[model samples]
Target: MFKVLLGVSRWNFLSLTVLTIALAAVTARYQGAEIQQLQLGLVLLLALCAHISVNAFNEYFDFRSGLDLLTSRTPFSGGSGTLPQQPAYAGVALLLALVTLLLVIGIGLYLTWQLGGKALWIGIPGVLLLYGYTQYLQRSPLLCLLAPGVGFGVLMFLGALWALGAQLTAGAGVIAVILLLLCSNLLLLNQFPDVEADRQVGRRHLPIVWGLVPSAKLFAAFYLLAYLLLALAVWFGLLPRFCLAMLLTLPVFLLLWQRINKALQHNADLVPALALNVLLVHLCPLLLLLALYWSNTATV
Candidate 1:
């Protein structure tokens, strides 16, 4: 059971779920909205199940593509390397993903019937994008990078909205959309190191397609944009004043940018993986702070 769980790649799947929960809770709290326990539990279950499915499917496919052939892939390989590098059977992982999909489809279908158009039309597609992301688009042009942002905006927000059975405010929805694009761009920059290996397997990532200089510039551009959005998120009255405290993340971001820039100049592999981990740690707390702030402010 533990091995199977590890095969699912919690960092890729579960981390997003945790991030989503925090974002939704923050949005709700700022509005003084009430949260439901039963609903939140179901939402979380759906997120985890789908996340695991994506990870498993990604593992199965990246292996099929020979992406695990690259050495020095540890410390990062973006989570799919574990099963494939070990020569684990994609068949087993594929089956697990299917089981998770069916379970979620069942729950999502019920939620749709009970909840209506938004859940099915909006929510399900949000979930389905994870498939397009890992399975197909991860190798596309800019699409590879853009896909994650769309998932962040669509899947995370829709999931939270569905879970609460509440209509999302325009402000919260917009904030989530910007967050999605910003964070997704951050994720793309995170893939810079894997570009070579991914290309060796015909993955053609943006960083690889554009080359190091362009990729690094694009990454730096987005990194700045992300901070701007965080600021705007506070200035616009969408979140509490304390949310501005996320600015404390700036120094870390600058450090990462410098690292990535240095890596690009020298064509080093360490920057992408190290930078991504740094970003993850930086953002997780900001999201959690927002969530906790929301929880404290909730009407109960």
Candidate 2:
């Protein structure tokens, strides 16, 4: 049951939230701002609950909507395989999702009252995105790209910044936009494999709405945008020069891009690309975290 819960939570992807929070915290440190450990812990707890809520709710909704049965489960795109095998767990998953969402709301309210009302600026949309994405947002082609991107990227990053006692600066704004683009592209690429299943259930994700080839082209463009924006940020002195460490992931990004470019026709062909993309997602933020840490310590 624990293993099933882990699977349903999509624990692997939860690291993205952690990395975003860490990036914000590390950025705070680099800027010589102090973060309350307790506050940071509460922020992380809320993020975890929100992530699990999204995952579990997604599983429950897909199972109810019959999308899970139609999907050919892949290592990446499909809903967790737990529900298709154990249909009885559906109610439990839904309950878990709602309970966690409430916890997130409670924490968010506390953070808002403690930090600033700006927390609501990020929090309200976050709650809506989590609950609506699987049902309503997924049906809107543009939102299918933007919702996850905004929820994980901009909202979480900004929320973390506020929690860490940093005023939202232009640099943080740059990071938020870059993250939004990266995560949006991540969802865009992963949608390719599930296009058929998603279509049957009325999901108009990028790969479906734009056609695979165009979406692939845009995916490639989004990758370049991430790097381009980072370079610009560093050049403009918004981010530290050491942020160039993120360039280390360029080779992996190139490999994934090449795979997507060359063989997008076959789902099998895109698997390695998907895997590489996931690695790049984690690796880029990780490198940024390290860069911030290095910058902080070097100056100290």
Candidate 3:
């Protein structure tokens, strides 16, 4: 049952949120701000709950809408195969989503009260994205791509800094933007296999709205822009020079793009690209974190 719950929550993808929040908190440390360990832990917990809630919510909706029934369950793209196989899990998934959402609300309120309304600005949209995304936003082509990026990248990143009582630095802002693009591109790539399934259920995601060929090109462009943001951030002294080590992931990024482009028609072939993109997303930010930590260690 716990394993089934993990599948329903798509727990693997939760690292994207965790790593970005860690980057923000680490950036706060690099900026010489003191972060309370308790506060940071709470914020991390809040992020995890929010991510879990979103995943479970998506799973519940997808199962009910029959989208999960139609999708070819790829490790990266399909709704967790849990509910489809064990329909009994549907209620459990929905209950967990709601319970976590309430926890999100409680945490958001506490953070807002402690940190001021800046936290409120982040919380409202975060909740809406988690709740409305499957039901509303996924039906809109533009928001389908933009909402996840903004929620996971910009809001979660900035929210972590604010919660930790750190001023948002220029470096933090640029990293947040990079995360935004990475996450957006992540959604775009994952949506490729789900295009037909999504379309059947009235989801107007990029792949469905713009033919897969054009969507693939757009995904490639977004991937490049993420690297561009990293480069510009380093050039302008917004990030430590060691941070340029993020470029080490370039070969994987390029190979992933090539595979994605070539596999537009081959569903099974696209899985490797999806797997590679997941690695790139996690690796790039993690490398940035390590670079900053090492640079800090060296300076001391």
Ranking by lDDT: 3, 2, 1
Clashing pairs in 3: none
TM-score of 1: 0.86
Q: Weakest 10 consecutive residues, lDDT, candidate 3?
A: 291-300
| Candidate 1 Cα errors over 4 Å, as ranges | 11-13, 78-80, 85-88, 269-288, 291-300
List model 1 lDDT by residue over 212-287, tens digit each: 6787677667657656766676577655556556666667767777777666667676646474644654484465
Summarize candidate 3's per-residue lDDT along 181-226 as a digit string, tens digits: 8888888888987788888999988888888899888887877888
In terms of lDDT, the poorest run of 10 residues in model 1 is 291-300
The local lDDT score (0 to 100) that residue 120 gets in candidate 1 is 70
Model 3 residue runs over 4 Å out of place are 265-268, 297-300
Worst 10 residues of 2 by lDDT: 291-300
lDDT winner between 1 and 2, please give it.
Answer: 2
Cα distance off (Å), candidate 3, residue 246: 0.9
**Candidate 2, residue 254: CA error in Å?**
1.3
